[model samples]
Target: MNYAPENSESAAAAVSAIRQMIETGKLPADGRLPTERELAAELGCGRRTVRRVLDTLEAEGLIWRKQGKGTFAGQPPDPTGALAAEIAPDADPLVVMEARVCIEPALAELCALRATGEDVQRLRKLAQRASHPMDADTAELWDGALHRAIARIAGNRVMLTAFALLDEVRMGADWQEQRHRARTPETMALYETQHRKIVDAIERRDGAAAFDAMRAHLEALSDNLRTSIRTLDE
Candidate 1:
């Protein structure tokens, strides 16, 4: 509420404020802004000052006002929509499962071939931490880490880095939170048992067995996605 711009801010702070709002994604492009009066109140400026600022913004091509409809950001900040956009209901969980099916079983096979003491130890640590006895929900963090650990054990930097992309997708779409909503105690127990089985196979250095176990995990996950989608369709 301190309308005083720091000395670093140039004389035309209002216009700068508007640009900052757009840049930081507080005001999404194609989204309407508040009324001039409301903006004035928030900015601690007079309505006339707000009008002057709006005129300057229009002149600079930073924004366009539609009279009664308010203003819109001239340039869409992020085409990727990291901070905006809805999760489309039809976005396929199958695609994620498909990637896991293709990527993870091979990852396990490589781990079986390439695992050093450090690699196996890291995988075991991740699995243990995720499956810590306190709460199963806490296991979900380790769940993601376990996959990344497997990829790391594969010794492929490119494959390991896919975890970052998947993490970004999960954040943007809120994947784990959404999936958690669909889970029951029976389901949680089922997944925990399956996860431990895969880890055990990897620890046993059974490459083919580990691969099969990993594939089965993805198959089950895909089935769950299918069932969930059917319920949604219903």
Candidate 2:
């Protein structure tokens, strides 16, 4: 606030104040900023000047805004969200699962072959989190994290992008509804076992075993989803 003179109405002064806030961690990275009105009041500037400052920060990759999500400090989120939303309507859960089954096993195999010591340790932590999630939301979150870790360890950029697209499409509400229906206590237990086996195989550097374990896990998921869809039709 002291970056600007008291009662100053200058855009330059407002920008300096906001930038200093970010630099000093008064505005934490990825944290939402004060509203334009609040910032304007604090800086003794008009909202127009505050708006200009925000626009300048965003253009410099220092902050970003979503339509209704408010301006946030730090670089903009990846462009994949926009792309995912665009293609989600056309995606079917079953087809997406099929794509995952095709891609993930190969990634798992590659991960077993190429993963560094650090990657294996991180994968173990992610697998542990997935194994004992507190609820459905956290289960999904950690499971996704576990799989994405394997994909990253696989070190195939093209395949990882493909995996990411399928992963994003599966987050659609319809897909979530179907997956939730398929998920039960028994299925969750089975998934945990399968996850451990996949991670174990990777830790052992057994490429074939990792490939087989991941494929089996995906097959189980596919079968469960198929059953869920059929039961709904019935």
Candidate 3:
């Protein structure tokens, strides 16, 4: 947990410590790391040294970072993230919803059947974070996390890649703005209820119920989004 740095080898020491953590599974794949400040403190090094170490690790494909999201301890997420960004401008939200309606229910069903106790626990925590989001941005973040958790727990690499692509597109600024605009108090409540239903079904290990709940939730989202867009056009 602590590393002593020689004069010019502080960055090297930090790198070794992080690499050790990764190798030992102390930092699991797709796991987020502590902030630069936190890492500096924990590693007994300067923030600059930590930064350099992170830069090295990132270039070596041992870790990756998103601007606002913290660094993660794995190879990057789906390579399609870049491609998603390129096509985001042309990706219709309704079309994306159609895809979700097709894919997410299956993920939910699989999650219900396959999720471990820890997975269900994490899902509950994510659901709670989403239901109590303080602002639109927070809501979007936790809500997306909740859905992604389900996909990950489903344990299908191919489906997860497809879902990740859609996730990246949905993270587009324009799409987020539209989603925010579409929000209303009643709609938020409905979403919260829907989220609860889906998580509950998964917790009970009822695949059919989980599938039905997820499909219902996505359908509701599609209906609300469509109505919001129509109102804006009018």
Per-residue lDDT tens digits for candidate 3, residues 120-203, read: 999999989988889998998899999999999999999999889888787763677678988888988999999999999999
Model 3: ten consecutive residues of lowest lDDT: 1-10
State the lDDT at 38 in candidate 3: 89
Clashing residue pairs in candidate 1, if any? none
Angstrom error of the Cα, residue 22, model 3: value is 28
Model 3: residues >4 Å from true position, as ranges?
1-78
lDDT of 3 at 188: 89
Q: Write the per-residue lDDT of candidate 1 for residues 151-173, one digit (tens) a residue.
A: 77888877766644544455456
* TM-score between candidate 1 and the true structure: 0.56
Q: For model 2, give the 10-residue run with minimal summed lDDT.
A: 1-10
Best by TM-score: 2
Greater-lDDT candidate between 1 and 2:
2
> Which regions in candidate 1 have their CA more than 4 angstroms from the true location?
1-91, 132-137
Task: State the lDDT of candidate 2 residue by residue for 1-234, as single tens digits.
Answer: 334433434878888888888877886455888888789789878776787789889999988988987888887767677788888887788888898998999999999999888888898898888878898888889999999989988999989888888888887546677788899999999998999899899989999999999999999999999999999999
Candidate 2 at residue 184, lDDT?
95
Considering TM-score, where higher is better, how would the candidates rank from best to worst?
Answer: 2, 3, 1
